[model samples]
Target chain A: MLQAQYVDGRSTRVRTVSLSVSGTDLVITADDLQRAEPLAGVVFDEQLGNAPRRVRLADGAFCEVRDLDGLRALMASARLRDGWVDRAQRHLPWVLMSVVGCVALVAAGYRWGLPWGARMLAQRLPPAISAMLSRQTLKALDGGMLLPSQLDGARQASLRSQFQALRLPDGEPIRWTLLFRRSPALGANAFTLPDGTIVLLDDLVAQLDNDQQVMAVLAHELGHAQGRHGMQLLLRSSAVGAFLAFYLGDFSQLLAAAPAALAQARYSQSLEWQADEYGSAVMRANGMSPALLADALRLLSKSHHDAAGVSYLTSHPPTAERMRRLEELAQLRPVQPSH
Target chain B: MDQTTANAPQPTAAPARQPQPILFTGRGSEYFGIWIVNLLLTIVTLGIYSSWAKVRRLQYFYRHTELAGSTFDFHGRPLRMFYGRLIALGMLLIYSYSVRLHSLVTLLVLALLALVMPWLLRNSLRFRLYNTSWRGTRFHFRGTVAGAYRVFLLNGFLTMITLYIMAPFMHQRLKSYQHDNSWFGRTRCSFHAGAGRFYLVYLLVLAAIIGFFVVLSMAGVFNAFASINAAQHGGGRVDPSAIFRTMLITYGVAILFGVSIGPAFHALINNLVWNNTRIGEHRLECRMSPVKLAWITLTNLLLLVPTIGLFTPWAAVRLAKYQLESVRLLPASDLQEFVDAEPESPGAVGEEAATAFDFDISL
Candidate 1:
């Protein structure tokens, strides 16, 4: 219950509005204001309904009450009368945004997502092919068994020692046979097969600066064996490139690259660099100068200049690049003392 | 004595109204159980379980949720939600046939439908969420998934033009929309308005790192070329050794391009998305310094490399909890008048009569 307040310098108190509730609606009537003013054209609700109800005072001012108790509460609490501002509703914009957010995720999943998934699937095919090629190549080399007893004593000992150190990712130490062939058809070259077989041509071994140079270069080949670079490349290429080959109407192009890819296995520039760095690290760890490997590259480049105009190093990139990388590693102070 | 007196309750003050406890009717265990069951079922059925499970999950959330002691009921039909998937699948089938037969028009039609199907489905879901009620109190969930789609499309368009430097700002604008649009009945949601600057910082730092790599590549190429030329023709006596040195330089270039640049970019993107976000009263806020965030993301990403993909779920859960716990709501109290009716006993002051005596003035 609210106490009525007296007006300043007036004999009468301020008028009170009475509320009547029915269901959800509240009806408000000011009896004193009606008696005093007798306003025209204002329809008075004889009964209150459940809907929101509004009442106009004698002064032509208006107020709305949703229910009986609401009307009473408003009169009691409204100490300082203030106007409220209602602009455009925010609900529509919010609804719009949540939809957009979900749509973006879905779109991203579709456009960029599915293609990557397909590529991942395609990437699984080449390792099988490379492993097959490596095993087949090794089997062929192993059949050409040249024993150390057939070799000259000094060269046989060095080859035997190097062969013992060569190992594959599967923990099988490589066996090498010396092929003393001087034919132009099978020129100076070295290659490894999948089943722990390393083949060194007589001419290629004879051309190296020293036994260590041959060892450093052989270690790089062994890196290819350890990393399974040939197999990985073969698998990746077959997976991605087979589709490309079919789309281009020529599978032979990929087939031609496959043999070369396996024989030399020119790694991605990163892998090649990693192998070089790894070779240098191993050389230094084994009580040899890392620069000795770079020196070996310099010697190989000289031999290429003398014979083929461009070195084997110059086939992919110039010799200077390989030398610079090896030199950089050599310059770094070894964290562990050289053995 | 003075300190104790100051701490005492003020005399003649009206008793403070006790705040209503926020009862989390949606239990974590219940939600987790539903998720686990759905996950198991999905795995068992080879993902076919998602269709029925999604409908059930939504129904469970709708049934258990309460506002003003009224549980909200979802009136939506279960089968209708698969409309999006159906439309997408249908369009894809048509498109595949068209492509196989070399029909350009059918392909275009398929593309257009693919763009529009999600939009239509979003509106349907929004309507369902909005029309639900808790007890007698209606749940007025704001924001349509469709509207969010449009904003994303527009933001994507803007970001592409700006070379993606505008992405963080665009993301923030999207958050604002999500915040402002959400409402409980007529009460509108609001957000902390000061987080845009932080989002911008994240964007700029990410942009700078990318720009650095692009510049670095160009510099590397030039350096490689210059070294080659210098070695080839530096003196009157043309040193053949210069060519061999050039071969060695390629190895170093490969390392920088392969390892350093790729990991750095991944780190930058991860940091911006992770560190910048904090759920405010209405919207999410990004407060982290982009550089610091990038560093942390990179470190974690590097560490996670050994775990394969197993660590991803753990990271996702942590991020979700962090984001959800940061969320705060504006203290907008619901105002409703409760009037107790009097019994119809004789000579009793009827509730209506007593209420009438008390002036229920309008304001």
Candidate 2:
């Protein structure tokens, strides 16, 4: 028999009692009260860790029992099986499997599933929505970071017309528009918005050699636009943010959000590589050599005094690697073949 | 002689009562195993099993918390919670999209949400409390819808209008409202803390944060940013990682301040709230130390990064153990005389919706 705290159904009164099993009947004995309950009619809470267990009597009364070993013995004798969840928890192997399984599952979801899902969703997003998002982003940037273009209006129009000549692989007209802005604080930068508007900063243009290099930079930005990389990156980071917050609900969301940002740096780096490849193809399709883009990158790299940071942390691929691939492409076609 | 050994016995029907300390029996390793299993199931089911997982998690914590020779229990049904989850998810998606779609849509959704927030929160409290039990009797919430609006919306506006100077007053009002309408079995809980005490706590916490900033500035950590800016102004390449590191340092400092301020606020407020709270004639007391709580929280965060969150279960258990064990009830009598309250069922929509929105009710 195990000592227990007994609470009758109708009242919150607790009575000291003793519990025992005899002939398929659960019996509760108190100083002045003796009660018998059928073993089948009783409800036993699953054993979780070593927490106190509650046995609910058929009449809604319950007994709190702390003697796990004795309770297990009674349950076994009465042919009452333990819950599968508790059974699995007790087995060391199942727990070990889950540890490895959970790690692998989460890693797989992070690496493969999240990116794929984001890419699919990004592509399916409406053009109008992307444009509106782009407008909002540009408006925000214009308010703080970006100033009006320092490049002359004539220069801007000439470059715009030059870039207008570039076409898709199918030779159709492109949808992207190249815009210029000056921001000394931002230093050298060129980026494509979600709506395919490419913003070229004056600092970056000042670092370049010729119109061809500028066109090459624009072509690279076009690649990002065509692939909807901005949208994909946004979706990816948001998805990672949402998932990590849920997965580590016990931990601070602030702590969890850090990893997602680091993960996003990796995602954006891959996107850079894809855009580089596309830029090479687009430049080669036009009369311009792929080396123009390579030259622009070299100049841009020279403009920045720090050529190196942790490559993993950087969103762009290494300049040397990108330039090497561009040089290889340039060598593959020494002269542009006439159609 | 059996029940007559009561010390400090008053000349009344009540027995000589002792302060019964609440106990926590859960260990980290056991909870870790359970958490892993639950996470696996949640992932396998694509988060559909989260409601069930939540139940198991809460049950483990509640059942392990013992007081007066009895442990608490949670009886939330997974199916009702799941239905609530669906509704919450739907509204969340609609609301988030509305923000991006148009300003008018955003305003409409916000208005709708504000109108229903009090009702939703009340239902959530009712559902959560009514499902929680000790000694086979349920706890309950009976705060009215109008009362919730008064405390939540009106007081919230007052706090905002006064530039948060009246925040402590609002907090006192909220705590009193919650406690006054709470019931455990047939015993009603009441609270009557002065807002001045809350204001004192908030003022002290703000001073503590400012003190930390002064000390940090004295330590010359602020000069690190100056050097970074000097390096950037030299027309040299800006190291992105350096900037990232600077941001990280700023975040670390902010978190350190939060660790100090947040725990102190909780400790002071919790102490004040529980000290003034009563269930029937019994009194509740909380003795949490802000320094101890802050140290534990800071260490937990530091350890979590290296372990990649494997330390989470232990950290959670550690905090729970400290916080729960610090609380005790000063019983007016033997503590077993109250009858069960009439059952009032509340839907899971409020609780699940709140979870979906990821806001804490601060219970």
Candidate 3:
């Protein structure tokens, strides 16, 4: 017999009752044994720590029991077994295996799966949608960060013609337009919009020693355009951001955005290497020295340190590594002098 | 069983007058196991199992918290919570994506969220309390949506207008609204804290922060600031160490202020709220020490940072143990006189919406 307190569903009155499990039924008796209720459809609450387990009866009355072992015996004899979740919670080895599996899966997803998915998705998206997105971004940039080209109109025309004349290694004719812009904030940089518009900053062109170096920089930007790196980066970061916020309780907005930005920077580093490889290939196919790309990178890295107090090392890592690879490529394939 | 002595246990005279302190019997090791399993399962299911995980976690905490030898229980269904989370995630996706489309759309979404926030908050409180029970009697929140809007939004706007001088008063009003409208087994809970007390706490925190910064500025720390100014005005010969020193001083001051003032205010407010609260004839007594709470918090953070948050379960258990141990209840009548009362259940939608928007108002 178990000591319990029973509450009737209609009234808020607590009555002292004696309970005993008889086969499949729970026999409840009054203090004096005058009244008794044998409950058939009895439901026991899930065991939570040392809390009193509630036994809900079919007739709407309920009993609270504190005897753990007795309740467990009753539940088992009644054929009411604990669920798989309860078993999982009690078993330590399974729990440890689950923890290891979860960690491995998350790490793998972060390292490769998300970026690969983003790349595939970006490639599948239509050019028209990417162009629209680029247009909106350029309009925003023009309104704040970018200024009209400070280079002379004749120089701009000559650079545009030279950029158009360069051919890619795939033998497919390049369809791209060159634009010149002056952005003091950006200092010396060249980037491509999704619509194949390569914007060469005035500082970058002025810093280069020869026209071949400028063309090499343009070739790298074209590589980004071909790969649609911008769209892929945007999609990948958003996916990672959503995943982080879901797993970890949504922290502050700035805290959530920081990790996504860092992940994107890491992705950008890999994209930069790919573009460097493409730039080297273009330089070699056109009978120009791949060393021109390396020379431009070295000059930019130097000027980057001199002009800005901010270190570009974190955002664009592997500059030194890519320069080394470019030098190796140049040595492997000697440049053919074409006047 | 103890029922053998039930016939002789008739206490017809006077009941015990001494107040009983609440007990937290949860062990860090046991809780750590549960937490790790919950985290693993939640991740394995791609966050779909988080609702179940949350329920299990809450149940653990609730069951381990004992008052008068009977522990509390949470009766929320995991499937209901899962549906709530799905709706919340959908709304969050829409809101986050809308910001990239246009500024006007973002503004519209913000305004819409603001309008519905009070309703969500009220419902969340109701849902949370309705699912919580002690001794088979469920806790209930009777706060209305209109009342929530008045206390949360209208007074919030006034506090902003007064440049946060009215913030303490607004906080008191909200607390009063929440406490006064809550019930346990047909007995209402009441709050009797004054805005003046809250104001004093806030003012002291503000003064301490200001005084720390003032003292730092008066010290030679401002010499770094002067050097940075000189560097800016002079040629590009900026001494990096001077800038670094300034940043170091700023960060140190900020951390010191947070460590000292944040815990002090938290302790004071918690003490005030719990001490002034009454459930029917029973009154709560809080004995939380600000210095002790601060020490525990700082040490927990210290341990947590070194472990990369692996000690979170232990830290949480420690904090809960301290808080629950400090609280006691003075019963004015026989504890057994209180009967079980169940209220209408509030569904999970409101709680999920509040969570989705991250509208976690610490009380």
TM-score of the second chain in each model? 0.46, 0.81, 0.80
Backbone clashes in model 2: 2
Model 3 DockQ reads 0.30
Which candidate should be chosen as best, given TM-score against the real structure? 2
The C-alpha interface RMSD of every prediction is 24.7, 5.7, 6.1
In candidate 3 the C-alpha lDDT for residue A136 amounts to: 75
CA lDDT, candidate 1, residue A301: 61
lDDT of 2 by residue, B1-363 (tens): 234234435535453255678999999898887888888888889888888777788888999998876789987777667766776677677777777755677899977877777776777777778778887777778888899999888888898899999999999988988999998766789997888989989899888888887876654465566666778798776577766777677777877877566776787788889889999888887889988887888888889888877887898899899989989887766654433332322221112222332221221
Candidate 2 regions with alpha-carbon error over 4 angstroms: A1-6, A15-43, A56-60, A77-79, A306-315, A333-339, B1-16, B87-102, B218-257, B338-363
lDDT of 1: 0.44
True contacts kept of each: 0.00, 0.46, 0.26
DockQ for each model: 0.01, 0.36, 0.30
Worst 10 residues of 2 chain A by lDDT: A306-315
Pitting candidate 2 against candidate 3, the one with the higher lDDT is 2
Q: Write the per-residue lDDT of candidate 3 for residues B182-253, one digit (tens) a residue.
A: 987567999999999889888877887788878877665567667858987996677988777777877776
Candidate 2's TM-score reads 0.85
lDDT by residue (tens digit), candidate 2, A227-312: 89999888888787777878667457677777887888778878887887788777877777888988988887776665332211
- State which candidate, 1 or 2, has the greater TM-score: 2
Residue A3 of model 2 has an lDDT of 88
TM-score of each: 0.32, 0.85, 0.81
